[model samples]
Target: MQEVGSAGTIAVARRPEHRGRSLYTQALFRLLTQKPMGVLGLAIVVVLVVAAIGAPWMAPADPNALASGAKLEGPSLSHPFGTDNLGRDVFSRVVFGARISMTIGLVAVITSTVISVAIGVLSGFFGGVVDLLFQRLIDALIAFPGLVLILAMVAIFADTDLPGLPEEGAISTPTVVLMGTIGFLLGVGGSRIIRSAVLSVRASTYVEAAQSLGAGDLRLMRTHILPNVLPPTITLATLGLGTAILLEATLSFLGLGVPPNIATWGGMLNREARSWMTEAPWLALFPGLALSLAVFGFNMLGDALRDVLDPRLRT
Candidate 1:
């Protein structure tokens, strides 16, 4: 009898671990075999990540260096993407821009996910007054036009100084402002998705059983509700990454994101690219292509993740 009881305890302990491994394995298999777009998206994402990390080594020339003799040159053996009006290498600038875009996408998504998860878990778990108040706040934020709100916020904080930070810190003031604004906007809107997921989990039999067994609210949330809600939360974060990157590009194009010295995809287009489009089309073409590919990859991956992670959509 003692041996049987010990074996039963061991089995129960290993069950969750086995289940987790199985789920991950299934998701991987489906992502690789069932979703062609997912595979393509993953490839594009991997390439961009590698390009961003290896910009210094991959780029042949300095992105900002003036090559007076190479001004307005078209694509050639010497300059694959050609030179801009200012004589800077278009390919090098595009390569370096990948770093900025990826950074903003990753940082904004992380910030928004944290906010969405915290607010959503609390609002859904604690219903009544807490839920009502949180919902009202979310509604207020939703009332504003997202792009307009972000533009206004960026304009307001564009010149704000960050005290005690060095002039050459990895993250600058404008980057912080952009990340915070984008994160806040996406986070509040995304909370509704998370809240709905939590509401469903909250009503489940397991949750009710745990409550009946004297599980505290924190334990119920941390141990049960949070885990169940992670699928949708991850899906939301994945989708939001593309949105954040596009928003940053838009802001930069408008001359309201990052510093002028930084070479962003949108900034590349916004600078002399617009005026020289008829003469030097490569200036705009390459940057625009990179931006489009990045957004498309993220969107495809997010859609595939949603289908894989959401049981309702699974085959």
Candidate 2:
């Protein structure tokens, strides 16, 4: 009897480990057999992530450096992407901009995931007055026009410490404020989808068995419900990455993100493209292309993830 109990304990302990291995193996196999679009999307996302992480090493020169007489210079051997209105290296700035853009996407997705998951789990699991109140609240928040809400939040927080975060810290200034505002809105909007997924998962036999076996609500939620909801949330996040970046760019273009002195893709267009589109079309072209490519990469990756997560779409 003692040996049998020990064996049962070991099997239980190994259960999660085995599940993790199976999931990893399945994901790897699916990636290996992924379609061309999936492969291309994966490549683009990998490249962008690398560029964002290695901007300092990859940049040719100081992205903010202003060379004498370099302003409005067309693309050439020295500066492949040409010089901007401030004579800064456009190529270097663009490379550095990848860091800002990708960071915005990541922060947005993380914030969205956390808030959405909490709201979704509560709403789906409780299913009473709690769910009714939250559902209405979420709906009301989603009813507002996003752009106006973003702009309003930016204006309201313009004078606060939210935008003036120090160079080195957990906070990232204006972006933190921006991301939080956007993330909250997105979280509320996305909670409904996750709630639906949670509802489906709650009805599964495994969940019923776990509950009957005396698993607490928190344990069941963290272990069973959360994991099942993650795939769809991840897919939402991948798609949201592109959306977040685009929104961030728009804010920067309107002089709301970072500082004007900082080298952001949208800020470059706002500062240089406005005055020098004819003189140096490359100023807008390259940055615009980068933004487009970033969005395209995320969207394609989201499509690939959808196919992988849903067996019916695996053709």
Candidate 3:
């Protein structure tokens, strides 16, 4: 009897220790061990992140500076990716664009995840009219095309003045709008997913035991429920990053994302550049390639994460 009791106690003690190892560490380890595409994607993303972080020091020349002779120049030792129509080094602009893309992706996914998790948990745990109402509301919103919603928000808020900028065109507006839009959409979707996870775990024998022991709702969620849900949440959020970045870039390409002077991968591939694609094919090709690479990298990483977190998905 004592041996069984000691074993059970030891198991209980080790449970917390087992959970303490960082999920990020585990996920990264899994990613490293995965297929070639996963490693390649991680490598590409790391390079872009490094370039973004070191843009000021790494860029060969000013991303915005213009020179009459440098305009439409082909690839050279001085400007490896060549110069755009405006004579700005395409390499520098591409490097700088990485910062904006990464920022938007990270911010939007994180914000959405937090908001969605909170609502989903609250609704799922309580299990009453609150859940019903919130779920119904979210379902209605989900029915609308996301693009139309973002466009509607843009039209409504376009004329509104931002704090630092004038009533005229301000990049901050779209940045905020895009981040919130993506976050809200993802959060709503995530709520359903998270709620499902919560429900599945809520009925477990351990959960019932905790409840019988007089654990509060908040305690049950914080200590017992949230941890189990985290792996899938993280996987979803990482995947969502690529989508958020792509959407923001789309807005930028549509002339609604960022300011004119500021460089974005999408802005670099704007209509004006497309018009000259025949004359200066490199103009659209390089930025488009970079954007595609950014999306691809995130997607591969997300897939790796999914495979790592959900063993069922792994071969």
Highest lDDT against the true fold, candidate: 1
Cα error, residue 193 of model 1, in Å, equals: 0.8
Candidate 1, residues 1-315: lDDT per residue as tens digits?
012264453211111223566776788799899999988988998999999999999999998899999899999888899999989999999999999999998999999999999999999989999999999999988998989988887778766777764443337877887898899888999999999999998887667766765779998887788877877887898889889989988988998767888889989989868989999999999999999999999899989989997778988
lDDT score of model 1? Answer: 0.85
Report every candidate's CA lDDT. Answer: 0.85, 0.81, 0.79
lDDT (C-alpha) at residue 183 in model 1: 92
Q: Which regions of candidate 2 are displaced past 4 Å?
A: 1-19, 162-164, 167-172
Off by over 4 Å in 3: 1-17, 22-26, 164-171
Model 3 error, position 235 (Å): 0.8
Those runs of model 1 whose alpha carbons end farther than 4 Å from true positions after fitting are: 1-18, 166-170
Error of 3 at 52 (Å): 1.6
- Flag the better candidate by lDDT, 1 or 2: 1
lDDT head-to-head 2 vs 3, winner: 2
What is the Cα-based TM-score of model 3? Answer: 0.90
Residue-level lDDT tens digits of model 2 in 121-212:
89998789989999999878888888889889888876667435664332456668888877777777889988998898888767776676
Candidate 2 clashing pairs, residues 3+ apart or interchain: none
Clashes of 1: 0
lDDT for each residue of candidate 3 in 1-315, tens digit (9 for 90 to 100):
012274454111112324546756776787787656778878878988998889888889888898888788888899888888878898898888888888888888999899888988888888899889889988899999988888788777776656775443324775777678888888888888888877877777667766766779888898878887787788778778888889878988998756667788888888436777887788888888988988898888778877877657866
Superposed Cα RMSD, model 1: 3.4
lDDT of 2 at 246: 89
